[model samples]
Target chain A: MTSATRRHVLQYGLAGCLMGLGSKSLGATTSSGVTDSEIVLGMSAAFSGPSRGLGIELYRGASAYFEHVNRQGGIAGRKVVLKTYDDGYQPDPAVKNTLTLMLEDEVFALFGYVGTPTVTRVLPMLKKFQERQIYLFFPFTGAQPQREPPYGPFAFNLRASYRQETAGLVQNFVNIGRRRIAVFYQADAYGRSGWAGVRQALKQYGEQIVGEATYRRGSKFTGVMRDQVEILKASRPDAVICIGAYAACAAFLRDAVDLGLQVPIANVSFVGSENLLNLITQGRDDGERYTALLVNSQVVPSYHDTSIPAVKQYQELMALYAPSAPQELLTESYTPFSHSFVSLEGFLDAKMMVEILGRLGETPERGALEDAVFSITEYDLGIGEAVSFGPERRQGLQKVYYTVVDEGRFVPLHNWQTRFA
Target chain B: MSMPKLFSMPRLFRKTLFGVFFLFGVIGVSTSLLSIYAVDTHLSKEYEANSKGIAKTIADASVNILLNSNLTALQSLIDQFIEIQGVSYIYITSETGEILAHTFVPGIPEEIKAGDVNSTTTVERSLPGMGDFIEVGSPILAGVAGTVRIGMDTGLIALKIQRAIGQQIYLICIIFVVGVFAAIWFVNYAAKPVDGLLNFAVGLAREQSSDGAKSQELLARNDEAGDLARLFLHFSRPTDGHGKGPQSGPDRSKE
Candidate 1:
C-alpha cells in the first residue's frame, strides 16, 4: 500500500527471477554421469565366472572403441568413460551391480550387460528408474525380454535376438533334412530363451525337439556328462543344438566324443566358439578333432572377414588399442583373443553409442538420449548392413552368421550340407 | 513302630503298594531305557542313510557345474541342499582334491577340513567345538569329478532322540501317578475288613466279649483275608473258651 513497500516487492521479484535463471544455466551439465568434461556410461556384466569370457571380451571390444574415440578426442569432444562392475553371469549379482552403477556411480546409461538372465533382471531396475531417464544401451545378450514390452522401451539393442540366431540355425538344419534335433542347454533364462527360440522355429516346420537335457549354469569342463549324452543319444537325434557357455558345452562335447555319439552339435554365439574349441582340444597326445561336427551361430559378422568395413575397422582398432580386460576381473588366467565375434559386436555397440551421443550435440542430456538414438534413420555401421533404430524398432541388426571350427579357428560356414554331412 | 509310612496307610496296604511300585519301577525304567536305545538307533540309521542319499544326489547333479569350475553355481546348488532337515553342511572338491564350494559360514571347520570325509562309506567325525557329524561322500563321475561330502548333525539327531525320551518319561510319570492312586483306592477297600478283624482279636485278648456279628460279617466275605479270619476265629474261639483270658497272660498283645 505504501511506496517503499511496493518498491521492495518489485526488487525482491527481480532478484528471484535472476536466481532462477542462474540455476537453469548451471543445470546444463544435467544427468548424473554427464558433466561438462566427461560422460560416463555404466556396464554390469560377467567379468568373472565360467562365462567371464563373454564379459571380458565384450568389455575389451567396447573399451577398444571407446579408447579409439577418446584418442580422437572423445565422443563429441567429451571424454566417454565406462563404469563397469562384474556380475559373474548370475542374476542376483547383476541386479546388485546394476543398482550400484546407476545409484552409486550415477552412470548416464547402462550398456553392454552380458547375459540374458542378467539383463532380464536389470530390465526392471531400468523401468523403475525411467523417471531418471536411465536406459540400457546395446547390452550383449540376444534374449527376447529386452526386445519386448514392458521392458522393451527401457532398452535399445544392437544385436539380433536369440530367436533370429536359433531360428536360422534350426531352419538351416531342417532344410538339410535334419528334423530330429535334440537340445542341450544351461538351466536358466538364457538357456530357456534359446530353447524357446528353437521350439518356435521348429513349430513352423511341424517339428519338435527329439530330446533335451540341461546342465546347471556355471558348470565347468572338469566334470563329465556321459549320462546326459546317453540320454540325448537315445533320441537318435540328427543333430543337437547346445545353448550354453563354452565350458559346459566343451565338457558336453568331450563326453559326447567319448560316448561315440557322433552327431552334429550346434552351439549359439554366446558359447564363445574359440573358447569352446580350445577347451575341447587343448591337451593330450591324441589331438582328436572334437570340433569336426561343431557349429556356432553368431549375431555379428565374422571378425576374419576384412572385406566388411566395420570388421576391418574393428580388427584394426582392437589390435591398435590392445585393450586388456580389467586385471582383477581376470580372476583366473584368461588369455584374451587377438580378435573374435563377441569383441566385434562389442566394438559395434560402442561405435553406435558414440554416434547416438554425437547427435545430442555438445550439451548431452539424458532426456534427449532416446530421441537422439531414434533419430538415426539409417546409419551405416559399414558391416554391409545399415544400423537403424526408431520408435517401432529397438534393435539395429537382424542378421545372424554361422561358423564352424576349422584348424582350431572359427571360419564362416557357407556350405552347410557338405560341412554338416 | 516298624518303618515310617510312605503314605498314611495300614502296613498290609503299604506292603501291597510297595510290591506294585517295585514291579512298575523295574518294568517302566527298563522299557523306557529300551525305547530310548531303539529310537536312537533307528534315527541314527535313518538320518545317516538320508544324508548319504543327499550326498549322492548332489554328486550326480553337480557334475556339470563342477566340470565348468563355476563355483558360484556349485555353491548355490549345495546351498539349497542344506535346507533339508538334518543336513548341516555340504563341501565340494575338485578332482585333484582342491576345495570348490562349502556351506560353513565362519569358514570350513578345521576338524572337517582335516578329517577324511572323502571316503565312500559314511564316516563319523567329532569336531572340537562343533559337535559330532556323520560325514557322507559320493564320488562325482566315480572320482573323476571329485567328491561331494555332506555332514549330518549327530548332535541334532541326539537332541531329537532326547526329546522323544523326554516325552516318554513324562508319560511314564503320569501313568505311575495314576497307578498309585488306583493302588491306594484298592488298599482302602481291602484293608477295612482286616482292620475290623484286628480290633476283634485284640478285644478278645483283653477279655472284651461281643462283636460276634462283626466277626461273622467279615467271615461272610470271600477273600484270602476273610478265609484267614475264619480260620483264626475257629482256632481262637475254642481255645479262649477252654480258659484263656487277659488275666491268663501278662497282656501278650502289643499295640
Candidate 2:
C-alpha cells in the first residue's frame, strides 16, 4: 500500500487493539509506564540489520541525554527510563514490538521509532487505542503519517518532514539549472514517501521527475545496483535523488561510479550519511572518489557546528555519558559516530520530552500530555531556531540543511550555486 | 496359471473361457506399460524445459543485481521463481565463484557444494534427503555476471507416471471381471444342449427309444443341435438298439 501522509480515518489512532490495555492497565491511580520514581518511555526501532545504525545511534543519543538528566535527579524527582525493542527495520516486527510495548510492557508512551514504514504501520494501532490516551512522542521520522490529520493526533514529531527536505532539495536543484531530476528509491512505504515528496516539489516548478528506479527493502552494500543505474541513466537526467538506507544507497553509489553515470546524487537524512560514506570509501585513500558528486539533505544541522547551543550540549552529553546500544540488541558491532544528524535529532527529541515531563509536575498523567505540549507557544531549543507547538502544529521543526562531503566529513553546502552551476 | 474344469459344462466351453481371459490380460498389461513409458518420457522433458526457461530468466534479471553485488536483491529475485511447482531449490554464484545467494535451509547440502558445481541444462541427481532433482543452470552476461542454477523435482514426474499406471491397471481389472461374467453366460447357452443329446443316445443303448420330454426339448431347439437330433431320429429305427452318439467323460449309465 502507498503511504500517504494522513487521511481522515476516524479514531485515527493506530492499527491494533491494546486488548483493552488502556488506562485500565495502570489502574485508577497513575499512567501505565510512570511510577512515583520513574517515567518509563517505550521505544521500538531497528536495532539490527542494515538500518540498525538509525536505531542504535538514535537510542544512544536520546538515552545519553536521559542519563544526564537522571544524574541531576530527574524532572521533579522522577527519573526517565527507556524500554526498548529491536524491529530489524521490518513492518510486521515493528507492529509486534509496538504491541508488546503498549500492552505487555505497558510503557507511558512510544518514542524514538526509526523508520517511516514501521511508524506508518503502527499508526493504525495507535488510532485503535486513542481513548486509552496512548501517545507517541517525537519518533525519528518526518513522514506525513505522524504529522497529518488522521494519525497526527497520536504522534508528535521533532524533526522536519521528508517532504520539506525534498522540497528544499528540488528547489535548490532547479535554482542551479539542474531541473531534469530522477529518483532511486527502495520499493516500500518509506521510498514511496520520499518519491512523492520529490514529485510534489517538482510540480511547484512545472516539472516532474525524469526517471525512477527501485530496489527491494533491506538491500545490502554488497548488492549489484547497475540495473537501477542503467534505468535512470537512460533518461539522461542532470541530477539524481536517492531515498534508501545507507547500505543500499552505498551500493547504488558504488555502481553509479563504476558505470559512469556521473551526476550529482542526493540522499535524504535517513540514508545515514556517515555510514554511507564509510561503506563506500572504507576509510582508505584509494582515490575512488565516490563522493565527487554527492549531496545529502538533512532535517538537523551539522553536529560539527558546536556554535549552536544544542549541538554543543548534544556533543558534551553524548561524550560525558557515552551511551551505547542495549547489550541484548547488539547483533552487530558499529563504531559510534562522534557527531551525526540522526543522533542530534534524537537528542533534541529527548530534550523536548523532558520539557513535557517537567510541565506535568510531580504527579504526571497521560491525559494532560497533549495539552501540556500545546501550551509551549515559546521555547528556545538553542539550535538558533524557534521550537514551538500548538493544537494545530504537531511538528516542532521545519528547517532542512544541505551537506556535501569534504575532507572525509559532511560539511554544510552553503554555496550550492558555485558547485552545481 | 490354468483354470481347471470346475463347472458342469463341456471341455470346449472351459477352453474358450481360458483363452479369452489370457488375451485380455496380455492386452491390458501392454497398454499399461506403454502409457507409463509415454508419460514418464514426456513429463521429464516438459519439466526440464520449464526449468531451463526459468533458470535463463533469473540469470538475465540478475545481471544488474549481481554486478552491483547485491546478494539480498539476488535472493529476492530467485525467491519469486522457486514458488513454481517443480522448482525445489535455487542458488547463484558470482563471477569469481563465490556463493552469492541460495534458497537452502540450514545451508546448501554438503554433497552439492563440494561436488561438481558445473551443471548443464539438465543434470539428474538423487540428493539423499532432497529427493531426485533435474538441475538446470544458465550463465548471466556470458559468465561475466555469474551463474544461476535451478533444481526441479523429478519425483513429481515419477508421481504422475504412477498415477497413470494406476488408472490403466484399474481398467484392465474391470475388463477381466466382465470376461468372467460373459464366460458364465456362454457356458449356460451351449453346454445344456450337448448334455441333452448325450442322454438320448444312452437311453437308445437300453432299447428305450421312447420320445422322453428331454428328447422332445432337444428337438424343439432352433440351433444346430436341433438339426443333429432330427437327423439322428431319421437315420435310426426304434428297434435298432445299437444307437450311436459320441461318448465323452465318465459313463455313469453303465454304473
The whole-model C-alpha lDDT of candidate 2 against the native structure comes to 0.80
Give the alpha carbon lDDT tens digit for every residue of A1-421 in model 1: 2243234335433543454455467775555677655688888788777888889999999999999988899866778888667778988878887886787666788889998767777887888888998999998878877787667899999999888988999999988888999988776667767877888799899988787777777888997777678778988999999988999999999889888888788998888877777788887544345778888999898899899999999989987989998764456678889998888888999999999999988778899998998998778988988988998899999999998877668888999899876
Over all chains combined, what TM-score does candidate 1 have? 0.64
lDDT of all predictions, in order shown?
0.80, 0.80
Candidate 2 chain A minimal-lDDT segment of 10 residues: A1-10
DockQ measured for candidate 2: 0.03
lDDT of 1: 0.80
> What TM-scores do the predictions have?
0.64, 0.64
Runs of candidate 1 with Cα error greater than 4 angstroms are A1-28, A285-288, B1-255
How big is the positional error of residue B104 in model 2, measured in Å on the Cα after superposition? 25
Off by over 4 Å in 2: A1-29, B1-255
